[model samples]
Target: MIISRACPTCRSSLKLTQKDLFDDRYGSPGKHSVFSCPKCGFGKTIPGLNRQNIGKFYARYYPLSNENPKEM
Candidate 1:
């Protein structure tokens, strides 16, 4: 998970904090958040995904590749 904020202008790193929108009262609540960069004046509002996020972990994008065919 991206736990830190990044400067959109300078591509540097910044600190992050929980925004007001990040309420956990809702069961399995979404990750809607607002973050800002300390180096440059860059901020953003990110509406996070809900329960649908589980699918990403189940699908393995790349499977094991076989050794060189000629070596078999």
Candidate 2:
């Protein structure tokens, strides 16, 4: 996918690159994309991470961290 977007600070085109997961303690597993600006070298995740799906991912890794662990 062409997940790259224009840089907010420099208004430059972002380049897509493969990046490994930074940390798996809270979340994040497997490979992901890193969008970077060639002009200013600004880098960030292509997917634009958020806590939207964190509940589902966290629940899978830490069963007891859910609101109702006994339900599982």
Which numbered prediction scores highest in lDDT against the true structure?
2
Q: 44, model 1: CA deviation in Å? A: 0.8
lDDT of each: 0.53, 0.72
Please give the lDDT score at residue 7 for candidate 2.
93
Candidate 2's TM-score reads 0.49
Tens digit per residue, CA lDDT, model 1, 17-36: 44656444433444556666
State how far residue 54 of model 1 sits from its true place (Å).
Answer: 22
Report the lDDT of model 1 for residue 47: 41
Candidate 1 Cα outliers beyond 4 Å, as residue runs: 1-5, 22-31, 47-72
Clashing pairs in 1: none
Q: In candidate 1, where is summed lDDT lowest over 10 consecutive residues?
A: 55-64
